[model samples]
Target chain A: MIVGERKPLEEIIESLEGAEKVLVAGCGTCVAICMAGGEKEVGMLASELKMAAKLRDMKIEVSEATAQRQCDKEYLDTLKDDVKGKDVVISMACGIGVQYMALNYEPMRVVPAVNTDFLGANLDVGEWAEYCQSCGDCVLADTGGVCPIARCSKSLLNGPCGGSADGKCEIDPETECAWQLIYDRMKALGRLEKLTEIRPPRSWKTSRDGGPRRLVREDQKA
Target chain B: MKSGSNLEKVFEKGEFALTGECGPPRGADLEVVKEKAKHLVGYVDAVNVTDNQTSIVRMSSIGASKVLIDMGLEPVMQMVCRDRNRIAMQSDIFGAYALGIRNMLCLSGDHQIFGNQQDAKNVFDIDSIQLINVVHTMREEGKILGGDDIDGKPEMFIGAAANPFGDPFDFRPIRLAKKVAAGVDFIQTQCIYNMPKFREYMKRVVDMGLHEKCHIMAGITPLKSLPMAKYMAKKVSGIDVPQEILDRMKGVEKKKRAAEGIKLAIEQIQEVKDIEGVDGVHLMAIEWEKKVPEIVEGAGLHPRPQVS
Candidate 1:
């Protein structure tokens, strides 16, 4: 399940401080499972905004809608009818979902109600953390499922950096050295010899160096 | 807004307080409710008109508040987010303020499934924390929920609920601290029964330094019967009366339970009053308003010292 937290209510209220009618749009995919931007949350947000407006003696109309999966255009299309005539839409989806809503609804304004923190799974109820950066590269097979690209604060691939001391990352005392985790995993799997092969310098071009990349499959397109 | 001029302010200002709750009419013939408001006028500082309290529908909170205000009793309009969207919530809040309903309680509201409106859609557009923050933002910063600066802000005496006896105990104080940080001026705790447990919880809150930041009013609900006590213990999520108290209730006869309940509630008030960091007590008679004055008097809590 995707783990995330709703942005502070004050910030959300500030984001939509003016104009009358507002639609609170929720995503039912990862954000739903995380209990951040789901149908339930959408209703709650709408109710709170309504009550707040009432306290201020100002007339602000709040409506709520939820998309099946905000990142998917098919699911986002569900909101087309709901967004019509609404002054502003507060999106409770991930960053991707927010962009998708903006792309689909050109004239309507879309605002994020949650901070897209990171790609992490819930270790337990109400706990979440960063796991992957999705840097358009894969090196986990040699590193025993630990990605130095994400785990190493510096994204180092080969061995541990000078910051690695006593098997922990110096930059963050809470973090274990990524290479240390790699060494232990490889040793347990009897694949320590894999570490002996020094990897060639990775090409930065295919990564973020190439701004905003896309891929298409001709066979699938037909 | 208007700084919540109801009876609650008297309590805040070191005056005796009188408070009551509106049981919203079961069916819409509001005469019974109006009479109930009339009965409370001589007694309470403010009457809290509940908004779809317990998720059971009745006359709208705005209407009830207006009735209470007209009846010569200050009304603390209890507004919940169970039924409206931000638009309606905002309008109703201002509507109440305009009509002189100042004291407001921001709640996430009860689930529709629990009420007769099962098919009704739930619009949680916001939770208690956010709702309180919205009121706080408007009152302190002069900004509305939409981020637009208001020509004039609502002067509301903001309040929130706390359940020290609720689950995730370790997280409760932290969450309460978060509400305090968000600008809660006062808090009405879930009904407190087990005094020792409540004292322990109060100590923890004081240790966290929240006691000084906000006024804490302990909730007191007089149980009318052993069965009622059992029902509250089993049905309520945040209240957990100790086994000793429950046992004592069971030992009493059904006819004597109401009196017993009042005695126990008075005992609770007396005990809680001496506990450090406890600012006051909120007597939630739960449809037993006649018994509140008795309970207060029995506990030696004089409303007049503060009322004048």
Candidate 2:
């Protein structure tokens, strides 16, 4: 799922500056499951924003609403009534949500409350770790399920750079070296030879570096 | 024309090349760079100008490279992929060339988290290898990245960094081979304190015949004191200081440790030059740029051969 974290209160407050009618919008999908931008979080942020506005003696109106998923135009249209006459809409969803809301509502200001981190998985209660780089070119079959692009600090296709010690990355000891994990997993699978050969430098044409990517399905599209 | 820099001439002359590193100051102070360049002027073939090394936000490396050029010293401009995107990188390439900087060293810079501005968004749009390919294409094909033709091509002597001490030891040389295949004309490896491991790496490099493909300059960073040695051993990545070297550093008098450090560096230089596949020695004195002359002199590489 897409993982995100709340922006700092100071930055959020500053982003809301000069706004009279502010809407704190939320997404009820991936962000909600990750505990980042659900209805509850939107309510909490709405209260804080109102309290902050009152303390500053600013004549501001902050409203709260959550869509089934702010990424879709249909869901974004559900808030058109409440969003009317708002000075700014503070989105509590991923970057897609913020853009979708901005597209649906032409001139009203739209601000993001969360910084989209990465494609990640929940490790434990309230714990999330990035699992993919969305490179579009997947090589998980060769490395025994380890995602080097996401996990390795340098993202070297060749494996760990000599700084791996005791299976931990040299930069961050708390993080496991992706190459080390690849080696151990490959060894257990009796496929150590797969890693011996030099893996070529990754081609970027299919990755995000090449350009802004899109999926065009002619068969499914109208 | 083949590389016009004196450093390239030294390599072309087939005599062992000796390069020194001079870091730019954090501000617009050109005096520090001039002072450092003056110390390295007659001793080394070329000087490498680091680009915001360690992400501390220094004066641009291209600006410092120009300073070196003004001092009658050749420069190898180090460009890290941590800061600029492709557009900015290509623009800088054209700018640096227009400014008369010749050599270029491609690097995947230190993560921004290690620097003072941890909050700064990193722009790793292209890795070092990709950066090399981009620069190589710009020079050779006379076209910008995305295959667009440019008004003129900027010729440069391409270089890249190699960390032989890092993990999955066998992959180090393979990575070097990849750099060679990617059009790296020269390679400046990570600093060498563990001669045995470096020797092993060089053997692999020679076996793969990478030395014949490109110039391999062994990196030699002098430790100023015991704390520096300890810090390198602990914090610096891809570095392994043998216990004996650390012990030697510990045995020195606090004040004399600087001299001892230079001595150790001299010994390493002499030893690394003897390695079969090694083509040159890159002396990185960090902030102790003044000590570079002594290291070059002690290593018996004084009055560096006039390659012009």
Query: Which model scores highest in TM-score?
Result: 2
What is the lDDT for B215 in model 2?
94
lDDT of 1 at B243: 87
Question: Model 1 - which docking category?
Answer: incorrect
Cα lDDT of model 1 by residue, A72-171, tens digit? 9999988888999987889999988888898899877888998887788686878776677676778888989888766765455445432344466644
On residues B95-208, what C-alpha lDDT tens digit does candidate 1 reach at each position? 777887777877656556557877886654555666777788877888767678876667777777787765335445666776787778777787888777788889999998
Interface RMSD of each: 21.5, 3.5
lDDT of 1 at A8: 85
Best by DockQ: 2
